[model samples]
Target: MADYQQIFQVSRNQAIKDVKEGVFELSRSAVIFYPKEGSFDCVARPWLTEAGSRSARGIWEIEFNHKLLRYIYGLTNQFTTYSLRDCGSLRNPRTIRLYESLAQFKSSGLWVTTHAWLNDRFLLPESQQKNLAELKRSFLDPALKQINEKTPLLAKYSIDDSGKFLFSIIDKQNPV
Candidate 1:
């Protein structure tokens, strides 16, 4: 008997292969916050899901809607799909599960990138490094009064700062 993981992989693999071969288009639209652009755009793509929801324990379940699958298919037809994970050590166990789950996919198309990750903490000067740590703490500190109480726009998506989202674009293929 096949496990749910195996079943999901089988179905997802076939979908990826079929789309890659140009049998049909796969596409979906997502409501994502783009902090750099300072705008929320309906990004159309082949498949979009909050990563690791399936493999994670507790309340988080992978939210897969048919609309997203279709859009993902269509988007894959045009541009390739890339996968990214949160940077640094796995602070959250649920996120770790998500990372591990995505790691097993057979598709060669997906490339791993670091999303909202501060690069090279060691590289910073001693004073600057201290500042960064303090900054991170300050951003995470709720007691500090902030303008955007709901969503603080921080530089580079630091939790210690008020940032919506942080994205590093490598290998840009025709910005959408």
Candidate 2:
């Protein structure tokens, strides 16, 4: 966990530097979670503090609304930590989201969903990629390929009679 924190710190610093250098602009409102209880949003922009400053005092910190701290604490307590290194290495956001979501199913290692469900889950606009074949070509194949090659887990996907995608994770140690 300490190693992950270090990695996160390095990545965060680089992102901050990039934003400061005008490499890219980030959205003012970044939402982390939206549960029934409340929502957690990130501060629009964060700046480094000078030495002896009151808040954060010489360190770079992104201020979040108070709700986020509670949300993070609850999340940490409820969930087990998984290696972020592999997920961070993924270039595709969809792949990373899918990988993390699948990690939640470590016990069963199986997930099934329709193309419509996948489109909604990944937040792809309906106007884009209308058919299953197109979805497979543009999104599914690439994400699966990257996940299988770059991560420790292996993924196998198939289409059922109802045209739903069935994904099963193969245990690397107990391959059949």
For 63-149, candidate 1 gives per-residue lDDT tens digits of 455655665568666653333222123343333333332333213323232323322312323453456555345432321222112
- lDDT assessment of candidate 1: 0.33
Provide the lDDT at 33 for model 2.
Answer: 40
Candidate 1 ranges with C-alpha deviation above 4 Å: 1-59, 83-176
Q: lDDT of candidate 2 vs native?
A: 0.63
CA displacement after TM-score superposition, residue 106 of candidate 1 (Å): 20
Estimate every model's Cα lDDT from 0 to 1: 0.33, 0.63
Q: Could you tell me which residue pairs clash in candidate 2?
A: none
lDDT of 2 by residue, 1-176 (tens): 23434544555546445434431132233344434553534333222112121222223334444544665568886784567665656877888888876666655878887877787889875543477777777777888888888776788789999988888986465565
